[model samples]
Target: MASKESVCDSYLSLKPEKATIIEIIRSLFSSDLENERFIESSEEGKLERKWIILVSVIVQWVFLYIRVPLAKIGDVLQKWLNLISINGGLLMLFLNWLRGKVVEPDSLSSRSVLGNLDTRIELDKSIKPENTRYKAVLSIMAAKLSYENKDLVQSVVNHHWKMKFIGFYNFWNGYQGRDSTQAFLFKDTQSDPNLIVVAFRGTAPFNADAWRIDFDISWCQFNKVGKTHGGFMKALGMQPENRWPLELENDDQHSQFAYYTIRKMLKDLLQEDENAKFILTGHSLGGALAVLFAGVLAMHDCEYAWLLERLEGVYTFGQPRVGDEKFGEFMKEKFRNHDVRYMRYVYNNDLVPRVPFDDKALLFEHFGPTLYYNSCYGGKVLKEEPNKNYFSLRWFIPNRLNAVWELIRSFILPLVKGSEYREGWFMRLWRVAGLVFPGIPDHIPQDYVNLTRLGTLLLPKETPKVQHSE
Candidate 1:
């Protein structure tokens, strides 16, 4: 019955020692230490079964003796008991399997896997080898440039053209230590002043394209607003030493920031030419910001409403919900003709996409087809699968239940609920039972892989190469 925060703290405190012991044990075992077979078999599954069986047997015996005689009552009672036993056993088995799957260490090392693959095959077919090599070289150059300027080159681009780069200024808010914002502008021989490309960074640092664009923009500064703070920080139990600028003041601020930033970038790019097109591209957080920024510009009645009309696309990778249901619907409507894609890449439940947000519907709806990838899951990487167009009731129901339970525990229950020893007793008993069960394999279906690929398409043409461990 420890609070979630307390539980997290306890886990963190023990992690170092636990990890060290585990490493020692693993080295001695020779077997793949990352595999969770031992823990699944020893901790969660079988342990639960032992307790359930014991309790069930005692209850059944008492019922057997006390039951009054009725036609076929004995037979009916026996059948019911058998069914209960079967279900209890099944539940234990399932829990054990799940634990084993989730707890297992990643067996593959990136170095070993990448070394073995034909670099040609590992490279995306759409990305020519020359292009990949060029990008890699550009990546090295950008890294050097960022190092020289004391700013990070978030990303580089080698898609169809070389010499394209994007960069960002590194600024730290008084509250949060360091905040980075992307500056995306493209320069070609036939530069269409109207054509503006805004590149968003994903989970990692920027590459060549982002660097090129960052370098092109003269007045660009790191984005200090619209960053997730209140709810997200609360969920993570994080508190800043000072007031964060991105802290939600009002809805208008959100809209204004989004509107002003996009307009300024567009005006700077199209100052020379009024008839050029404007395109927005972001991966992950960048994508969500691009969508919001574009929507704000549309609301402002800017002269380039046609550019908004001619909005080429909004490509996002592993993006979460950025706004409320109304905002999401507006985005979908505005970007209907222009490509708006969200790639949902999951490495065995990485837990980023599922971050609790106010407008769950944004993720559930508005976004186009979701590409789900299970490459991070054990076993062979399978083809991707597409999520249903709308929010799934089945998935939502469980999520809601969990959310409510968490809310009650954190907010409501602490006020009214009494501490009960029975709950603790049962939990410990269940944990013990889990220790005895056999481990089960976690299966990654091919459908998930296809979905991930579909999501990847939304990003600039770089495909994250998957390298396996030895």
Candidate 2:
């Protein structure tokens, strides 16, 4: 059995349920965090750090109360959306309902709420295999599809993308003590030796577990690699025994760890076809996992250097900061040494990319230039996206005005780009939400899909001029 308590030496773990009202308020001024049963830390926490912990616990407490109802609402909404699709349209749905001939949606064939919001299952036709943007386009598509069901994934991969569906998995999280992480693998035949793409699923809209993980400020330190998000590491399937062992013996009976299992699969496949390369990608939380996956491979470089050599790239969209400054330096060195391409994409005002608070209080930071696209689909390579920390009084009206432009762009894009760029009714509603919360709607895969197809800037070639790298 994996013992969660014994996982890391220097760490802070939050248990909101174990806290009291007095303790929660007192934590802000308290230095001895280890003294509190609700807070677990290797050493005394700074007053500023405890403030973050207080916010985290409070948010988690609220989530615990709303998790079930939120999930129910999402379930009902997804089913309703699937009904509209299954019946062929909203009008058709109504007409069929009057005649008592409405079609029921099959759960296996239906899309998740994230999928229903965008509803584009096909890859961009204009982006060819020869195009430099092809992998990034394919990556965003895979990241979008990752939100859908397994059958939907197979259908899209086989019928539309003309790819082989490897498998869909629900991997185990040791800390969560159950299967909490999800990812899927497929092989793209468009390339000569066939490229295998492993896309980790991003945070689901209704999943409280994922939301809690995202908000958790807990961290664990590695010898020379620096500290990383404890929630993300756990979600990536870190085991309690020695954290990350190169190989595990007689592990057949135990639940599969995402890192080890995916690593083994890629190793075997690469060995079978020597010329094949692979890419890791995801959107939002998935994006964090994708980059960290690459980071971990680099960490075990001596034993698994072959995987790094065969890795084509890592592309992430609306991805949050994963680790500290030192960790960022470590990964940058690894990428530079391995000649691996790491493209972190941020569509205008996407809040997810700017999180886990990169400040003096929190150690999380995003490394490398961001391939940022504004609402007009204008692209730039920047060291950091504007409004690096999202909550800003300075950007308040400007952000909402930008949101208004996005809403207008939703109407104009179809005329300028094509019918393919037209926003769906549900997607437009999400854009409305942007008026209130500027970046939340922008975090959706819809804008990401549009930007990849319409954005002008080609990466790497356009990146090195130091366009916005202040």
lDDT scores in order: 0.31, 0.83
lDDT of 1 by residue, 1-470 (tens): 11111111100000111233354344344443223332211122213222222232233333333333321453354343333333354465467566773222121211111111111112122433234222322211221122212111222233433334432433221111232333344432223332345553332222222221211101101121122222111111122321223223454433223333445556665656556555555444444445555654444333445556555445443444443344455555555544433233333222233332223221222333333433222222223222222234554454344334432333332245332111222223322332331000001111122233222323344333222321
For residue 82, what is the lDDT in candidate 2? 92
Question: Residue-wise lDDT of candidate 2 within 113-184, one digit each (tens)?
Answer: 998888788887777877788888999999999888888899899999998999888877643434357889
Note the clash tally of each candidate: 56, 0
Give residue 216's error in model 1 in angstroms: 32
Q: How do all models score by TM-score? A: 0.37, 0.93
Which residue ranges in model 2 land beyond 4 Å of their true spot?
A: 1-9, 20-32, 45-47, 174-179, 253-255, 461-465
lDDT of 2 at 311: 91
What lDDT, from 0 to 1, does candidate 1 have? 0.31
Q: What is the lDDT of residue 114 in candidate 2?
A: 90
Give the clashing pairs for model 2.
Answer: none
Instruction: Indicate which candidate wins on TM-score.
Output: 2
